[model samples]
Target: MAGMCCGFVGEGDSSANSRPSRRRNLDMLPFKYIADMTVAPSGTSRKRRQADLSGKKDFESCEGSNGDRGNEKSKKNKNESSKVSENKPSTEGNLEDGEFPKFGVTSVCGRRRDMEDSVSVQTSFYEELFHFFGVFDGHGCSHVATMCKERLHEILKEQINESQENFEWNSTMQQGFARMDDEVQRWNSSSQTVTCRCELQTPHCDAVGSTAVVAVVTPDKIIVSNCGDSRAVLCRNGVAIPLSFDHKPDRPDELIRVEAAGGRVIYWDGPRVLGVLAMSRAIGDNYLKPYVISEPEVTVTERRVEDECLILASDGLWDVVSNETACGVVRMCLKAHMMTSPAESPANNEVTTDGSDQACSDASILLTKLALARHSSDNVSVVVIDLRKDQRPTSNSNYNLIN
Candidate 1:
């Protein structure tokens, strides 16, 4: 077994600022994909992942793609002439002709000063296996989100084994979140060099936390565990099916839960728990204690033949783009992918390492660009997984991923 590096964080990720940013992309109009991305193949089940950093064979793979707004702008300009900007595939990357991209991700700084959002994707994570995709929106700092990127999947894997056949969705997810929260609390309590813009002391640093939305895709089911405002949306038969809901403070049930737990929801511009964090449930934020809990709301959905794709993203995208609209955009991209040639596929398209199905990648890049164009105030991150069974690789394919 190798360590995983499925998560990637943008430099300008999450900002704790609750105020809406009105910054518009007047200059970078009609954005093209400038995301620094390293996409890989999801074909075959038992093959080992390529080593990311200098480490042992039993190491987890964690890959990060860095892209600056300046760099993106410059690159965007050069590629503006070409309808679709393409990056050469990694020499070692492999994908059969016509196989849909297993997943596509795009994360950017948006209007924020620092990057705090993280994305994780792991294919065939276990034997008799399943695939994993997660998005964590870090506020106050990026450590919590980074930690979750590194450990949450491992924690949940243990929980799954502990539960065995009768996997208690709520219980398993709850335990995983609790263990992750504990780890964050310990890390935040210790003395460490601060990296993010929020230069708060240890006492204040304890206030930092992240929103987590994780999806585990098995052979027949999609299980989602969510805390805070991040979300997982399943597109089936062209309709949006929300797998995990945002845990905002103002949500009726969440408001009641916070109040019952001796917390207050005050409107400091927008509804927030105790007029602070906008979301009621999060991974860290030890200062909030029992008020802002870490218990996750879990949803298990059986896979359907009409399934199109699964979308997981941070609030940066969801804040401006509705689930229906996001699904619609993806559907249209997929349709265009089927109809158009690679050269004329999209205005904002990035080539994946394996020359993956551009439909998913195009949709993700477009969504991120849309969020920025709409002046989303936070870091934007999106993952699109093709759910059309026909697009998936056959059982005999053994394509390996390269970092």
Candidate 2:
């Protein structure tokens, strides 16, 4: 089986479940995100704003864009109002929503021999102005991550709709993840959706698993749910805020839970659950059972005026770049292009589209390039959403590049 463009799996290699651990000294975010490692930044769609950051040159400057920090302060002072409606994002698969989702994304199979990551984006998802974004990193095979890209959002939405209270994000997120894990098992038990290397072999394809980080953006709030190592970050007023924490096996709380469940954290390169998976939680990995569960940690934050953008990625980019550095780069891009591309107006009701804003596109491109520049050895995926409303910063950012 060939490795995919977004997710990579060697032709016959099945060791991805035990992907090597890169850090034991992760830097901390304001939300206490354990950064001793790089989580692959994930959100969806390859067709929109795709660019190869592997090249040595810096990105071509956007129209009216300038470099240098001095101009940012003066430029940021001017804000605008618009009548355009919120638009739907591009799809990670073969999806077409007619135009840009107003978010920017980028993913690449850098240094890694194959690709196995998946991203998904849907705007105005549950109601008017509510949106969904997610990134998945598959281990053991591409199917698990791909499966997540195809259905996790629907599962989450289903849970939300089925709820009696409807908007209790925390409980609904937990149930959504539980249902997703069940679906993976049920689907794997009977058939192999893709011509995956796993060949649907173990019971319910128990050998496979995936790391997921998902976010729901509403007119007034940002709700994030995470399982495994993928991450979601909020760039608020120049500070990098982590919405979800990583579930590395070595993390104190995670290690304690694993031990209580009678599972061992083995040091295979770094730390692994029973010397198998490096993360203590994920959507699948049924063989790990009680130890490696599908329950996601959820965080909800109110939207603020100073919010710059939201970043969601897999460990691939985080492994090599720090949270502050990533935020700094994106902020620079947005500021440089402030005059040429002002933020989108918050008044649009229905959706319309074309492509991502230039600054966001530039930011996503530069981040991936920076990751490769730092020699990241895995798939790199990123999604940047301009949350600055009434003063939109190019409106959005989205790009994807894979093997």
Candidate 3:
């Protein structure tokens, strides 16, 4: 595996389970497992494995357009007497109907490596204006990531629906991760698991796992849930505030938990749990069960008028780009579009064919390209969400905290 170093630049850069029952609490997302400290046999995915798992479940699985954000806001602000139909795109508008919470997404296979990464964008799962975005970085194989790309949101939607009666965002998110991990584990052990495409000739199998970061944008709040290192950052008033914490083995809390679980963080190339997986939590990788967990840390932040956008990405982009730099780049891109086409009206699903508007539409693609240029070693995946509406900031001087 290529070494991925962590660095922060100054303003510039640079689930569930299947099988047996165990006492698990959805309230606090607690994880308990029977202790077995035996080392995994040579050639297995995990160098260590816990025996006869109990008191918790095994890892497993479950389950975008741009102008989407701005377009919706325009819809709400449209003249009351206007004849524009709510169901269709306007002939005179630059955006398609219902495209608000605009999305820009892109992904690329690593240099000479299998593209195990997967990204997803979902709009209007619960409400016409709601949105969900995620980036998954798979290790070992793409199967687990693919499974999550397909079903995580669906399960999450179901959980959210159930929570509507009571409305506990954090608990709902935590439950969703636990349930999804179970599904992934069951699939990994099932006969349906297939061998994913590999270009680097590295190891690939169902024993693989993926790092996931997800953001759900509602009218009032942005709820983010993450496991492993993929991240979600909210660009509010030109500053990037992290919404979810990365679950890395070397992190103080993570290191303490690993040791308590009888696992050691070894620095072979970088800090890794049991000298293997670099992440402290993830979906799948059954061999790492009871050591590396599946519980997700979730955050619920209320939306604000000062919020500019939300960025969801794999480590491919974050490893090389600083939060401020990313926020600045995206702000500039959106600002350019606003200046180039100040009179552009929101149309129904209208596609940007060329120029700066087109560039804004490809925000995710542009971010991925930038990461690649910086020599990111892992497969790259990015999803840029335009959370602002009305007009672009006139200058950097306009940025200020919402409070």
Candidates' C-alpha lDDT: 0.64, 0.62, 0.62
Question: How many clashing residue pairs, candidate 1?
Answer: 15
Clashes within 3 Å, all models in order: 15, 42, 34
lDDT tens digits, residue span 304-326, model 1? 77888899999888888999999
TM-score of 2: 0.70
Candidates sorted by lDDT, best first: 1, 2, 3
lDDT of 3: 0.62
Candidate 2 residue lDDT tens string, 1-403? 1122112123222333443522211112011111011112355322222221211222222111111000111111112111222222111112111222346666665544345667676654553245678888877776888788778778876775566433467888888888889998888777545476663366457778889999987655788999988889999988999999989889999999999999999876567788767788987777888999999999988776677788888887887888888888888776655534323521132122333355665687788778767756566777777676423334445421110
Cα-based TM-score, every candidate: 0.72, 0.70, 0.71
Backbone steric clashes in candidate 2, count: 42
Model 2 ranges with Cα > 4 A deviation = 1-101, 192-194, 199-204, 341-353, 390-403
Q: State in Å the error of residue 145, model 1.
A: 0.7
Looking at model 3, report the run of 10 residues with the lowest lDDT sum: 7-16
C-alpha-based local distance difference test score of model 1:
0.64
Ranked by lDDT, the better of candidates 1 and 3 is 1
